[model samples]
Target: MRDRPEAAPGAAPAGVAGKKSGNWKDLRARVLSAAVLVPCVALCVWAGGLLYGALIVLAMAGMAMEWARLFGFGLETRRGQLCLAWAACVGGTALAGHWGGALLVMVAAVVLGPALWAGQVAIGCAGLSLLWLRYMSEPGAGVVLFLVACVALSDTGAYMTGRVFGGPKLAPRISPAKTWSGSIGGMCCAVLGGMLIAVMLPGALPGAVWRGALFGGLVAIAAQIGDLGESALKRACNVKDSGTILPGHGGLLDRFDGLLVAAPMAALLSLGAAGGIAFWYVGLH
Candidate 1:
């Protein structure tokens, strides 16, 4: 067994201090990235239609590339094949309304990706599913925007509350930084912000604000779960961050990990009456 060297009398622990210092840099980078990303996301949402679709597809493609790189497939021919399949899955679903193609890709990934590229497969499928959430749902774009906003608010709440309170860890093994205080704070923010947005809608649905609050709270829950899932993946893969693609966020996957799982689940909850798309806007007057 190797020995852990003792710290000097007045000096900080060997690696701990460095980690603490790096955190500030990471947080600052996150803020800088958010400053640019938030406006762009809002604009695309407002624009709607092809603009939003194209942007999301591009992101998915980028994520696919990054996933392959993460799996050490960057230099292999499989990387191109996987990336192409991923783009087809996302773009097909977005442009041509094709779920079968995406499904096929998932099946192929499972069969061929058991040993390697499983994460890539999951990323591609999840990315496409989210795109489908935006593309296929009736009044989908609005719901997508709401989900994104709630998740964003939840993240902000978690960060602020966790830092301020510094209480018990929520899932110490999965994510050391998470805490119970952060969870509660995130949920509260989600509910309150969702209600506010619900009230501001053009035609407010009956109990729309309350229901929206619930939706937001649920979103926070899902986002946290996704965050944990990603953390676990990182732990298993023995890496930090997916990539350096995003200035502060690390990679597209790192930034949007929460949305990967949350979007699809939310879509299911908001399913429409006609067996297609979510009627999430139904109650909105």
Candidate 2:
């Protein structure tokens, strides 16, 4: 028999070292991706015309591809083609101000592929809501920015808090990394962001801290729910992520899951309010 090898003089076990290092293994890639994409997204949102529309189209296409993959469909497959077609119609109709046609298309797709088309419809409606908020709402860019900022803050806060204060899982079966601490931390961060936006953009938002906080809380809840929903879907599909288009982020759908549901909710609230996008703080006119 061969002699056993001696341990290193002062070395920790490989598993221990690995656990420590792996805690933030993906941070660098996540930061780098955000650094590159955030500025581009902000610029496009600020310049809400062809540039923004193009960004939306590109995102929808990426999301559609990911959705198809989640369902075990290749781009050349009939289901994949239908998914892409739905994506195209949604983007085209949203940009062309024909949202009614988009709704009809969504219904048709749902009927054609009931199992796969539900999420596609949600994503399509989100795109439509974003377009409506940008081109049709009173606050336009400011409202979109506010929505983006709150969701971003929530996501960031949840990630940071979950890593630092590991505890009971929020939904271990769906996403083991998520925790109750992270969820609360995210909601708090979102509230702060909302209040800050209200202060900075008094013309676009109401001046009441309570209203800002309320709006932030609601958006955070919606965003978190969206995140959980996507996680469940990924779990059901037996996948770790929706796709791999964005390094560390997995895919466009993974990154924008929160925004997907939140946008439509925000738009619906705005539509029913007297002040449109600024209705969070503004009273009935």
Candidate 3:
């Protein structure tokens, strides 16, 4: 090292070593996070019957708890009632085996009635519950998977697009990270994901690709709204992350916020549209 140039007076060897150690630590953390996330994701994807349903139920329960925490509702008080109401709704849908007019009526009555009578918390819980029920009662595995895929794709696209092509912020107050370019990119990705899912299905693509694209675009918008809604709650509570249940991911609620909104809308659309895009496409068709 040609007598090894004298180390800078302020920059000790320890500092350089510390920096390398910090990098290794960060790398280890990321690797560990992926190690856990990958297996869990694989399990959910491969096991899509009762196991998947159970997972969904657990996820909804966890999300409900997180929501209650975010809103400052005591778990012993309002949360119990909320869970009960949600259970009832899910039970009703499962029993009926059809999410048509009856399902909508039940959800509207429960959510609006409670909002009008009990309070905002009641309404919020009911709304979330309805979304959960819709997610649970979706007809086929494929449609449910498709909806999830769209959300994932949208999120991924939005993040990448926003990072690479910075633009006007979508909502500076609610979520500074969100951008108009990201929103458009997310919508595009969602549409592409939906079309790809449709093509993969067994039968002829029921709804036109354009229709699926429109639905996906709408879902992307709704997903962002949902994300912002959750962010608002987090800001209100003065919490950085929801529960820190996941290593790198915040919490179950953090992960599923978009899905919570998108799933129900997709379910509703599937039920209404004539195209074989319904959740029950597998069973009904």
Q: For this target, which candidate reaches the highest TM-score against the unseen true structure?
A: 2
Best lDDT goes to which candidate? 2
* TM-scores for the candidates: 0.82, 0.90, 0.66
Model 3: lDDT of residue 59: 62
lDDT against the true structure, per candidate, is: 0.66, 0.77, 0.55
lDDT of 3 by residue, 1-285 (tens): 000111222333456565344323333443587578657754764465555555554565566566555555545775545643554454345434554643453455444343222222332333333343334533355555666667767776776576557578776565654678777787789888877766665663555465557666777776777677766666656765566776544676666677656765665555554543444233334
Of 2 and 3, the candidate ranking higher by lDDT: 2
Writing each residue's lDDT as its tens digit, candidate 1 over 35-77 gives: 9999999888767678877777787777676666656667367
Q: Per-residue lDDT for 1-285 in model 2, tens only?
A: 000111122334456566456667777778899999999999999899989988887787678778888888878898887787778788887788788887787767775476668867877888888888888876788888888888888988887787777678787666666888889889999999988886677464335577778888888888998888887787777776787777767788888999888998888888876756564654545
Who is ahead in TM-score, 2 or 3?
Answer: 2
lDDT, residue 151, candidate 3 = 74
Instruction: Write down the worst ten-residue block by lDDT for model 1.
Output: 1-10
Candidate 3, which segments miss by more than 4 Å at Cα?
Answer: 1-46, 73-139, 206-208, 275-285
Scored against the true structure, residue 205 in model 3 reaches a CA lDDT of 50
By TM-score, how accurate is candidate 2? 0.90
Task: Report the C-alpha displacement of residue 135, candidate 1, in angstroms.
Answer: 3.6
Candidate 3 to truth, TM: 0.66
